[model samples]
Target chain A: MRPAGFLVALLLAAFAAAPASAAFQYYVFREFGVAKEFPLEPTRREAEYRTPLLGRAVPATIFETTEDNMVYRFTVADMRAVDLVARSAGLYAECIAMAEAEGKVLARMPQRVEDGTAFRVYGQLTSVDLAEAGGRKQTNCFLNKGWLYKVESIVLPARGEPNAAAALRFSTSLRFRIDQAPDSP
Target chain B: MRRIAFTAAAVFALFAPPLAAQEHEPLEWQEYAYPELGIAKEFPASPQRQTGKYQTEVVGENAVPSVVYFVDFGDLIFQMTVVDLRAPEHVLRAANILAECIFLAESAGLPLANLPLDVKDDTQFGVHGRVVSVDLNYNLGVRQTACLHKDGRLYKMEATMVHPEEEDGEAIARFVTSQRFELRKP
Candidate 1:
């Protein structure tokens, strides 16, 4: 067999040998103090996040990666100095506005997770040229222990509903490390 | 008397645009696209474009390059200023550029009106932008401004009415809502 064909066969064989969930790897990031599962190691970078009510921009760390035409991103910002309750509404509004910026928001709900308050939003992003050609996005925000965390997944229209399961899995797999809880923020 | 007349003529020349702007017939709306700037919006007429400098807190002390496309209708004014914050020294501050621009506008006006509480609120302006309406101090009328930051550029849009009492509010709303930002193609 040709070298290229042999490589394909090897890849197929590896996939067949492992269970679906076995492909994902779990990692603990001491710096961000969170443990999460990702299909591959996410690229880390420093970015800025906007505060809800104060209209200020604060430093944030972002982890992002793409797999099979789907994008997964996680962001964490320390907001210890700000009042979360007073700014909770702005926080939620900003998240939803971002989703609606590209498309229409399909649904949203406030969910009480294991340790924090999470807001889940579903959006249908429409293409500017072709309205029918659009993608789906899922954004989940968490306010826990004075830290604001956001997990987002985007599946291109080409990937469609086939990658929905993986997107959902990646978005829901973010777990904060309770043991390594840092300062209040 | 001749010196006074000469000064009066100079003053009138300086203010003639606004007075002449009011004499036009009904506005003919048109859509103008600046592909290089990554923005497209509607204007009452073909707006004249000017390049200038704008100072903001994020890029303190020194002013940055800016481009403004605007149309001055005697009774109304539509202006959009695009500030390039990608300079080597100011690039890192791009994320906070919009907040600083909003702060500058807020300082010149009264308190900000209540923003939307719900994300689904339809009252929100273009694509996650912060918008506020300011009542000018000297009867310059109401100026509604929206600031959006994207791709290291700060887009500031303003629709000002010189005679708000006589002008229709729908015209301002239409111009504000007609703005659409073009995504840069990689």
Candidate 2:
């Protein structure tokens, strides 16, 4: 009986030693015609989008990740401009202001890269440390053919930076509907 | 005779002045009409009136029913809308869905704030008024309001202020509630 118990414990230890696979999931929000893949399991929530100024459809998809317990949001809007950089700069200012208002600091040395004439990408690394709770977050803003597209992910645990990696991957995978154009003002 | 004539001319120039002098005076206030709002209003006539690009239009299909009017006031842009919910169930669903979406957006660090509902009792429409929401960082403000009338039509008002001001609240509220919708085929 002692030998049998030793064998059982050995089997349990071996099973636990096996490499565990990371949970990865993907979600597609049809209203915005955008898809996102996350490193951890996320719950889906539906949202209605409305703006008083444009009165345009502002539908969104929200994903709640498990590890950092951070909510990821995707929003798309159609806007037109003669110059892409000007519009992108305007959007970046708005995003930064919004982030600051929520008590999140803008990460220094943001990554900036050019995509094409119609699109440009910029990202930041942010952290929110409170007495009770603390976490790190990353946000990416995509300017596409007069459309302002944004994706943001947050991760808890100062060391486990899942959101930063996910945000980079998501930014590289962004695509837009060709038919939608910015509404005339 | 020459001295008399020069003196007479000098007196005339000093006292009579010129016809152009009257033009420099400020213009008086004049009653004007905003045909779109269906109300006659008054404004100072000094500043020349310029035609603006802003206009009113109905947006969204039956799947998403809303009407919007855009007005350009110099540097600011004002948008007003009337959303038709059609039923009580629609209102309840919309309210919850909108609230959740806003919360999710805010959690992601978007500039959405001042979310609240407006409920009141009246005769034509049992409930009316406006609910205010804002994206301060974006300099965007939204007002969502609703009413249920005896005609069995549920109406909602959404007013967006791109360049907001203190008086915008009252202006938007008045514009939204003053709207009249047809219950049946017009």
Candidate 3:
């Protein structure tokens, strides 16, 4: 069989062997005293990046991977460097600017999870969206436990369809270790 | 303005926002679908559909056709209006819905107030709307309307009732939550 065909068979075999619930892996961040689950292994490098809105350098751990033509990115930012992100105009403006830097904003909605955690979903309209015919851009942010967590995923029809349900599941699985539970916000 | 919506939805309006939690008992909801608009939503009962037309611009002579699907559950009325605006120039025309809403309240000889808070109620299918509230009229109660633009079409949803209580607020949230817009392939 051709190499491409063989790879498809291998991928299928792997999917058959993996349990449905084990699609994501969980990790515990000791320094931050937070435990969370992720879809892919954490990248080996830690990087400092500038937030266009906040205008400050903050430490960020990024997990990025591509599968079936879809791009997935998950970022955890330690916001301890600056004052708390006051739910004010500045924070709102920063969020809008950050999410829409490359594409026109399609929709932006904030949700308050049942557990009292708040999150916002930012949708961007992009050219690739019209080309892919079914592509969508979503940047999701959850502000909780003194950290800002973001999950971004793009759905391209030519690739496998993106799993919004799984993305949301992974994001909601964030937990604080028992040791830090006493002071967790 | 403080962006964080408070339970101080208490201090600002004397009532909390319906977006946060469904604090009331669930009502029997029936699925409502509008194929002409390519959207479906859950409503407590069958809604009354109203069709009308208004000028896209206050001074323009062209009439923009519109439809409103609404229902009243006791003291609250939930309404959704779809305005056909496939014309490229309709972008600016869509915005006039807000002022049109204001004009409507004033024409009825009622005092209306604008709440600067922007509600973040966007569906997963990519429709976002902006919310504003008004005093409406003596008997009609308060009105909160959200306007959304997509595919050269304008969708405006409104929740209006007189003297809304906590239960009414929860019901309004339910109405907003149940809305789902269908994005069909061309």
Candidate 4:
């Protein structure tokens, strides 16, 4: 087989059987309402929170994968239940109160993607909730057609493979399932 | 084939007078400002800052930390790299920065020509370099690279496009001429 095709096949296999080895793969997530792709199959969890604005139990599905010491996570918070209210600012500020963010956000810029504007923020991601070491996290959060989504990559140098390139690929590959027609996601 | 032409032109550029910018009307331009580097210049479009590492010398052994500002517009790939040349780990660094263009043009299969540059800043040195057309898998492209060095950092800006064929030389010339450098007060 051609080298490119062979590599793709190997990656897909690795992604399917992530527990067995350290190989990374392309994983498409359909568990959530929207489809997202992570580098590996990823462990999945769901959490429901009561919002102060509407007193509604909002649901957010979190998908995460650890490889080469890096952590990749995608959070899909369906705000349709709350009429797509912009409450992310409150959430971000509430978390900051726990521990002043290590430092200011290094950078945040609007990224033009297929659907619309996605804001990407990155810097030394530190939390007062946990003991600090060294590493960083980059997050891209955006609202598309009423749904709010966040794609995050945490660099863990102590873990093993601080594969930053792979971490970025995971975030950049995120889309609201292009197969669905535009404005429908 | 490309190597031979690049070597000869590099030798010729070492002694040649600085290339003069072609006369042309200004095109729409945008400012690319980097406060950290204390330098800013105009580009055809908003540029992206990319940080990476590269070989400090022609030997390709010792790696030098670098940040490259790059963009793609119309038919050209424009790039500017700022390299920290203070010290790598082992291999000796080249004192002259003009040689960087020759090495890069040869590896990319683009024929090169260059000459010493004269600019406003006394602490700065520059080169007016050009690359001829060559097939790059998908298309035939040529390149124009202008290099400058100041303090302990080397700055290089290059624009490459498919078969520029002398017609687009003015655009490349405009880019090289648009270069501006500032000296920070101690």
Q: Could you say which candidate leads in lDDT? A: 1
State the displacement of the C-alpha of residue A17, model 1, in Å, after optimal TM-score superposition.
71
Cα-based lDDT at residue B37, candidate 2: 33
TM-score of each model, in listed order:
0.45, 0.31, 0.38, 0.36
Q: Which window of ten consecutive residues has the lowest lDDT sum in model 3 chain B?
A: B113-122
- Model 2: per-residue Cα lDDT over B7-81, one tens digit each: 999999899944331111232434444333332323223223333221111111234444444444432333333
Which residue pairs overlap in candidate 1's backbone?
none
Q: Compared with the true structure, what per-residue lDDT tens digits does model 4 show for residues A84-163? A: 23232223222222223433344432233443312112111222212265566666544433344566777775754444
lDDT per residue as tens, model 3, B24-98 = 334667877776786776777778988987453331467788898888665667888777766644443332333
List chain A TM-scores, every candidate, in order.
0.66, 0.48, 0.56, 0.58
Tens digits of per-residue lDDT for model 3 on A101-156? Answer: 43544544333333222211222111223233546556655444345555566656
Docking class of 2: incorrect
- Model 2 alpha-carbon drift over 4 Å, by segment: A1-35, A40-44, A48-57, A67-70, A77-89, A104-106, A109-134, A157-185, B1-186
lDDT of 1 at A129: 16
lDDT of 2 by residue, A1-185 (tens): 99999999999999897545344445554555445555664566755434332224444445555443444555555444333222232333344334434444534223334433222233332333322345655555544334555566555565355445554454344434313433211
Interface RMSD values, listed in order for every candidate: 13.8, 17.5, 15.5, 23.4
Pick by TM-score: 3 or 4, better one: 3
Candidate 3 structure, TM-score to reference:
0.38
Q: How much is B35 displaced in model 1, in angstroms? A: 0.6
Where's the lowest-lDDT run of ten residues in candidate 1 chain A? Answer: A121-130
Off by over 4 Å in 3: A1-22, A82-89, A100-110, A113-134, A162-165, A176-185, B1-186
Off by over 4 Å in 4: A1-185, B1-27, B56-60, B88-92, B96-100, B110-112, B122-139, B163-167, B183-186
